[model samples]
Target: MAKQERAVRTRKALITAAAEVFSREGYRTASLTVISRLAGVSSGALHFHFPTKSALALAVEEAAADRLRVIVERCEKFEQPEGPIRLVVDASYQVVEQLAADPVLRAGFELGGHTVEMGSSGRVCDLWQRWVASVLEHAQGAGGLRSEVVPGHVAGLVVAVTAGLEELGRRDPRWLAHPTLTTFWRLVLPQVAPAGTSVPLQFAGS
Candidate 1:
């Protein structure tokens, strides 16, 4: 048990160090040597946990996904049948706001963009798509969305929009600020929700 605990701690340290380096230098420029040094572990120790940079990157993506799933699950508990779409939109913005506040998330986003095709960071997009799909399915079941629109397709659109918005936010931290994010929520919720339903608007700023 002691050995397993130590191993878990070491792996966590390595991942944290790798996230920092990858965020700062980007995936292509980041080196395992630097990560190992920053993690206060030997290169052999680092390799024992993650054989390659791609593996480490994937681990980072998985960690981020796990954290996001937890948040989304928590938000789902507050879902209301009358305004499910609005609830989802508000929750989406809240998630983005939380990510913006987290250094690890910023790092993951940077790495994801830079190594989208080369590492596990690419899976992050798919994970986002799945999450959106699940939310859309719930909204559809609750009669919050139109029957004509397929949940998977709507989910894909939402994921695309979110990815675009995230990229924009990463490039310019001020892009999704107060009024702007509110405008986004207002615009998107109406398109997905049943007609005549007033979409609730809430900004993280307030």
Candidate 2:
């Protein structure tokens, strides 16, 4: 039991260390030596868990996917007093928060962008788009959206805007902060929601 616990700790440490290096250096330039050193583990141990740099990167991507799944599930299950539209907006903010806080998740996005193959959640952009589309569809069905509003268009816009924000976050961490996200929602919500639907532009958690 103790040995298994130690192994688990070491594996987590390696993944965390890898995420930091991968986040800073990206996949091609990031080195196992640096990752192992950051992990305070021997090269042998890193090799034991991940045979190659690509393997470590895959682990990071998988772990990132798992974390993203948690964030998505949380948003899906989270209760909102206002309506589905507000829930969708707030959920988008939550995703930004996660990206801001977790370098692994951020790096996974970067690494996955380099490859055509989809990572967990079927690519970050797709995941965000699908969720927004789902919420927008629900809002339309519930009569929460404006009659002229198109859910598919709204979903695409939201996905594009958020993708741009994630890219901008690479240069300015503040892009992921509440100020920018809330401002966007504040401006856009009115256009998306039905007139006087009581949908607030700001999220309380933000």
Candidate 3:
């Protein structure tokens, strides 16, 4: 039991260390020696768990994907007062929050955009864009969206804005704060919401 626990801890440490190193140096330049050293584990242990840097990078990407999945699933389960659009807004807030707080997520997103030779798992950004599109489709069906709103175009705009904010937040973390997204929704909600709908700016913009 003790040995199993230690192994889990070691694997986790290696993944985190690898994420940090990969995020800082890029996949091509990241050193196994640096990862192992940062993880405080021997190279032997890292090799035992990951075999190769590509395998380790794949694990990091999977882990990051899982985190994003949790955020979306959580929003789906929660009943928002303003319906799908509000849920989308809340989900965006949660994503920026996670990106700001979690290095593994940051590294995963960074790595996703890079030309790493990891296996065939889709990029996190692509996954996120698909999710946004699906949510907007739901909103359109439920009459939550304006009649003129094209779900695909709105999805594109939301994805582009969120992706831009994620990049900007790396240089200035304030870009990821609640106010950033709140203000965004404040401006965008009226445009996207049904004509007669009153956007709850007070709840979100506050």
TM-score of 2: 0.85
lDDT of 2 by residue, 1-206 (tens): 99999999999999889988877877778889999999999999999988977777777777876777787788778677777887788777777888888887787677676533423434556666777898889989989899899998999988777777776887889898888887887788889877776765555455
TM-score per model over all chains:
0.80, 0.85, 0.89
73-169, model 1: which lDDT tens digit per residue?
A: 7877885646556656766676677556654554555556645666453465677677777777887998989778687887776666666666677
lDDT of 2: 0.79
Model 3 clash count equals: 0
Candidate 1 regions off by >4 Å? Answer: 81-83, 106-122, 147-150, 176-178
Please give the CA lDDT of all the candidate structures.
0.72, 0.79, 0.83
Off by over 4 Å in 3: 115-117, 201-206
What are the C-alpha RMSDs, in order, of all predicted structures? 3.1, 2.6, 2.1
Looking at candidate 2, the ten consecutive residues that score lowest on lDDT are 114-123
Task: Say what the RMSD of model 3 is.
Answer: 2.1
Total clashes in model 2, counting residue pairs 3 or more apart in sequence or in different chains: 0
Residue pairs in candidate 1 whose N, alpha carbon or C atoms collide under 3 angstroms: none
Error of 1 at 111 (Å): 5.1
Model 2: per-residue Cα lDDT at residue 31: 88
Report the lDDT tens digits of candidate 3 across residue range 110-188.
8776624545466777778889889889989999998899988888888788778877877798888778787887788
